[model samples]
Target chain A: MSMVEKKLSTKTQVILTLLFILGMALLLWWADKGFDSYKQRVLRLIGIYAIMAVSLNLINGITGIFSLGHAGFILIGAYTAAILTLTPSEKAMSYLFGIQPWIKNLHADFFTATLAGGFMAALAAFLIGWPVLRLTGDYLAIASLGFAEIVRIWANNALTITNGPLGLKAIPEYSNIWWVYGWLLFTVVFIASLVYSSYGRALKAIRESRIAAESMGINVFKHQLMSFVVGAFFAGISGSLYAHWLTTVDPRITTMGPMLTFYVLIMIVLGGLGSITGSLIGAAIFAILFEWLRDLEQPFNFFGITVPGIPGIRILVISALFIAVMIFWQRGIMGREELTWNNLYKWLFARRKEGEKS
Target chain B: MNQEVFFLQNFFNALMLGGLYALIAVGYTMVYGILRLINFAHGDIMMMGVYFAFYTAVLFSSPPLIAAIVAVAGAAGLGFLIDRIAYKPLRNAPRISALITAIGMSFFLESFAVVVFGAVQKPFVQIFKTKESKVILNKVLMVGGARIPLLTFLVILLTLAIFAVLFLIVYKSKIGMAMRAISMDIPTTALMGINVDGVIGFTFALGSALAAASGIMWAMRYPNVYPYMGFMPGMKAFIAAVVGGIGSIPGAVVGGLLLGFIEIFTVSYFPTMSGYRDAFSFIILILILMFKPSGILGKKAIEKV
Candidate 1:
């Protein structure tokens, strides 16, 4: 609490943050140039998942908005990016059912497509947020879920724009470690900064008590809508990364449904809903566990006997863990506490004082 | 077939489908009415019911009647256990926590089905029907030039019979009264010496049984069973419950039938739009939520804050 300690903490925080960024740069370089194809892919997926969990945290965790329509927005982003970035010939191959001439001829670079995707999803959130945000609690959740389902069903039926369930194939693989991690870092800083600013405090107040926030002159709807749009923008960016990483855009239920939203939900809940670093940690753990669980579906050796693979046993285990966490450890890893330099400094100072006493 | 007959046939199909949905919707409306939990696993529980029946008849070579009885009882028990295990611990927790748990329970049942029952589709015929003997269920009825199956009428009549019994139990039974009290005010109901948990468990059991009955009938109409079979119907039924106005029993049935009519009529009128059948229901759901958030029959709920 002393002034000198505060000054030291501020300086240390800046230096540590710079070092951390540098460390990440080094790690990214190693992963991109040194790691194998599979490792790179996993790394990319981890980055994308972090983006989703952190952004989702802003709305569901920070702002207390239970929106399940992120998957729908992701679908929008993915389809938009896929359409914009696909070459005319690639579009021709996928649209065996026929396509609108403008979309067929449409083409853009990966960055432009991703930006367009994010903007499109943001636009959608703005349009729907007015009506959907008015419903509180479970009504909001269900109505948003309905929106996602409607998007999914329409995507499957809209032959001209979405390629009608055949989905776009031959998407460019542009989501390398650089792009994925770059966007993830930006997302973390953007959301964390917003969470700590005056706006962030206002958002938290709205979450605690909307009426109180309104009484304090905080525009509850505007803030909720902002968080929703921003969260959706990040989700859209992640969707673009996901599409480019997978090199396809099938908008199937498994890929873009309540299940996908649930996966992100689980990540945020596990990471401690309100913590940015918590979500990042949660995403990392989840990404690794999900990939590892795939082995459960492949034949494995036991102590004495070879056990046959169980296809869905992995999801069963994860889902079980989700319930257990909800029942036993609901605060998650962070519990609204962030891992920061000030806390670090205080811990070190207390340690020195204890050493002197000992 | 003539145009009139085709229309008649589709109408009958809609009626049967609507009846089946009504059966499922009752389960959802009852549970949501009381616990304020969406019971996301309701559909999966119905799916489990079909599997329970499928196994009972297939593995044990039991009669269809026995399979049906076992399925209803099994689903009731599962529903009860789901409450005891998952929802009970979180009764006093935040509503959001309960909601997350509900979604998790849904995934648990689904993956459990996939791992245990296997993902492949299985034939869902009634037990002991020999190939040569035409079962009464398989027999078709011709009325006004429309060839309708006897099962169609059976499904509709069976739904009505169940609804009448459900009405009696809900409006007349002690447990039903307890359920009604709990829904109105859980804390007050508890204060008044009603065993709120027991009522909730009973509500879940009753709802699960209804879902099972509908699942069994749904299987007969569709004639194939898979682990994921209940999901679509389960979702549609909830929407049906909402359309009729959630938390209202009569509203659920009316909503189910209305939704069924919309789905069938939409498909019949525009065959090209058949793939978008699911979308129409959701479109209707969104519009309903926007215009009349309480649903057609639901009372207007005043926001507390």
Candidate 2:
């Protein structure tokens, strides 16, 4: 009976995988054709966030590294891609504080600029990871948070490079649904494959018990560093995509002050840590809800009462929601389980069967 | 001012700032010692304390001293309430859950403050303000043509007094012994028939009272109170706690002073790099964690396999 079930599940998995791809493609196509520019922007944001959430899951979920430095990597990638892709005229216009001559002369096409951005971010992660990954638990969290703030400070003061917080503008809006979704698809596939491989197993082992994994001959530090670098690489790609999409990149946008890192953390936590499908769903829900919550910030008539706009209520609501979720459902929506067809089938039929037997 | 005067003045300023940080750092160190959880909302509790003082004194027309008393008491009460509501239930849950709840609570408090108090920076009624501006406000002693503000002297004195009181409480008191035991091993301490929950509540109350006192003093010094004002200082104080050896009380004070000196000296010497002053704490934090994870006063723990 178990053999038959396994075979049936394998066949079902193939069909479900194809269906999922087809559904996503159709959704993207419909969004591009049917939605307004504002709605389309939201869709694009969802895709970029999917990439970010998945990448962060690689570090925080799969590897159990509590890094709060996603904003720093995002800053690096955004600046790298923006500087590389900006036309000389655009650069001259944006850099009011005397552009660096070396950077001014350099420009690349969109694709190369993005790849280079990812590479630079990965390189930074590699260098920082060596010393940082040594620290564990809350210490690691605080240290990484500090690193992100340091990055923001650098961006604000490094006048020649980051334009001294005036920020980059008109960086050529080249990102669209296609670029975002393509990268999102690539990130999901890459991370899913990595999470199923031997290295991924090693990461999970380390997460469960560091000493045990070490005794089992698993190179704990090496696997952790690998996860950190890979996670940073994809985060960099997402940042590049985001920068191009917005046509603007600012130091404040990448700072902890704006709570960008917090939002990403919320996404992964709410979706369910250690689950790839959860990350995707969490990102989608976050993007949509974030946009939807803007209504709460604006003035609206309720029962003929003209309520005034409450400027910061959006974050207030989200933060409250985050607390509620943490207290009531600590394991989050997905828990450690994936949202696959086989799991769904087992949950639906097998659990009921067991209940009946009992 | 001459170079000598400038240096002396900055040094004095650093001392006062260090004292303020130490006061706040004590709260972080104590709670962390007992709970082994970073109460992310501790800073916001400080903010609440400041606002409480502001409303009591300015809005209700109470005296500054009375306001300070009420605010500190209120903060202690809020701390107890927070532990009972947000943290107590999660005592046996994963540490991450409690940490996240703390972060969420921090956000909730800040947002709630913004909604209630409005997001604008309000001018705190200066407790030190006097009718004769120059004689009292700028009252300073000249030593070799270097002037020292009286307020700085007062702040340091107050910090020292607070520290002495805290030291006496922690070392000489029976409850303090219970706190130490609980920090070492909660289960064993409970098994020994101590009221662990009440002791934990008292710990929160004591730590929060210190934070409140610091917050009121901070408002008096800075002359403004806003919802988000506690974030940077709170973060710095937490860093101080870690630097001093997170679970050690005296370690926190030393760490706070070191951080204060580093910040002030860096600004005085490298004026152009003053913008990067905030980054210095983080750099120091990372260095300390990497080289000495146990910190200056923290004992290294061995994990059981």
In terms of TM-score, the best-performing candidate is 1
Quote the TM-score that chain A achieves in each candidate.
0.95, 0.94
Instruction: Please write out the lDDT profile of model 2 over residues A187-267, one tens digit for every residue.
Output: 998999999899889999998888999999998899999999999999889889989988888887324233777888889
Docking class of 1: medium
Candidate 2 ranges beyond 4 A from true positions = A1-12, A253-258, A348-351, A355-358, B1-3, B125-138
True contacts kept of each: 0.76, 0.79
Alpha-carbon error at A108 in model 1, in Å? 1.0
Model 2 scores a TM of 0.95
Candidate 1: residue B148 lDDT (0-100): 94
The residue-by-residue lDDT of candidate 1 on A262-346, one tens digit each, is 8999999999988888899999999999999998899998787899999999889999999999999999998887878766666
RMSD each, Å: 2.8, 2.4
Q: Which lDDT value does model 1 have at A235?
A: 90
lDDT of each candidate versus the true structure = 0.89, 0.87
